[model samples]
Target: MSHKGCCYDNAVSESFFSSLKRELLIDTSQHSAQQAKTAIFEYIEIFYNKQRRHSTINYCIPELFDSSFS
Candidate 1:
């Protein structure tokens, strides 16, 4: 689908990466690509996509997200 006018298309992806970098990359102990990848995977799968709630999701987590529309 064309996302030319859809902020929703890019918004969550950006927010997720920002949170991951802020929480993982800025940590002085994370010094390697492997460490960064592990941290990001954990953050995305465990935190962002599962436990952490989002205001945009009407405070629901990803498992509760609707797929009927964008």
Candidate 2:
């Protein structure tokens, strides 16, 4: 858990949610809760984890980073 008022402790999570809002949520409207849930799932599993390049990982996709350990 992050310490109270320590922004650095939550920087990674903050960055992720910021990207999610910017990339997927802004200007898009979902018809239902389930629809929003599905969209978020796809964004995380298919795009964010499998396709998007993260600078912290030297611009490698998260799937590639995981595979390197196998």
Candidate 3:
């Protein structure tokens, strides 16, 4: 296993958390860890992954992207 304190070992994870905190966490002020978990889960599952539009996905939201692929 890699050393515990290596900063380079976590670059991707840090980037992901930075993006998440910048994009999602800043929009919310959750009081509890459980609430934050649930809110993040819903935002990713119900909104971002399922309904949010991505330019990389050809301007269609995820839900429509799947249908168009069929």
Candidate 4:
């Protein structure tokens, strides 16, 4: 969390949700809560965190970008 009344507090989260809606939820429909949970988990862990290239990190996979620091 950031300081009170900070405008940038939700910037990262908002961007992430926007991408998630556009990339994963636009075409897919989940029948149940469990199914939605599973789909979101896979989208984040398998695709977003691993396979997708992020422009913010020089078009690198987020996992790879994190690994480079270690």
What's the candidate order when arranged by decreasing lDDT?
2, 4, 3, 1
Q: What value of lDDT does candidate 4 attain over all alpha carbons?
A: 0.91
Local distance difference test scores for all models: 0.75, 0.92, 0.80, 0.91
* Model 4 Cα shift for residue 53 (angstroms): 0.7
Q: Cα lDDT for residue 43, model 3? A: 77
Error of 2 at 7 (Å): 3.0
Which pairs, if any, clash in model 2?
A: none
TM-score pick, better of 3 and 4 = 4
lDDT of 2 by residue, 1-70 (tens): 8679686988888899999999999958999999999999999999998899999899998888999999
Q: lDDT value for candidate 1?
A: 0.75
Residues 17-44, candidate 3: write the lDDT tens digits: 6757777899999999999999889877
Give one digit per residue, the lDDT tens place, for model 4 in 1-70.
Answer: 5797564888888889889999999889999999999999999999998999998999998888999999
Model 1 agreement with the true structure over 22-47: per-residue lDDT tens digits: 87668747679898678778877788
> Which candidate model has the greater lDDT, 1 or 3?
3
Model 2 reaches what TM-score against the true structure? Answer: 0.77
- Lowest lDDT block of 10, candidate 1: 61-70
Inter-residue clash pairs, candidate 3: none
**How many steric clashes between backbone atoms does each model show?**
0, 0, 0, 0
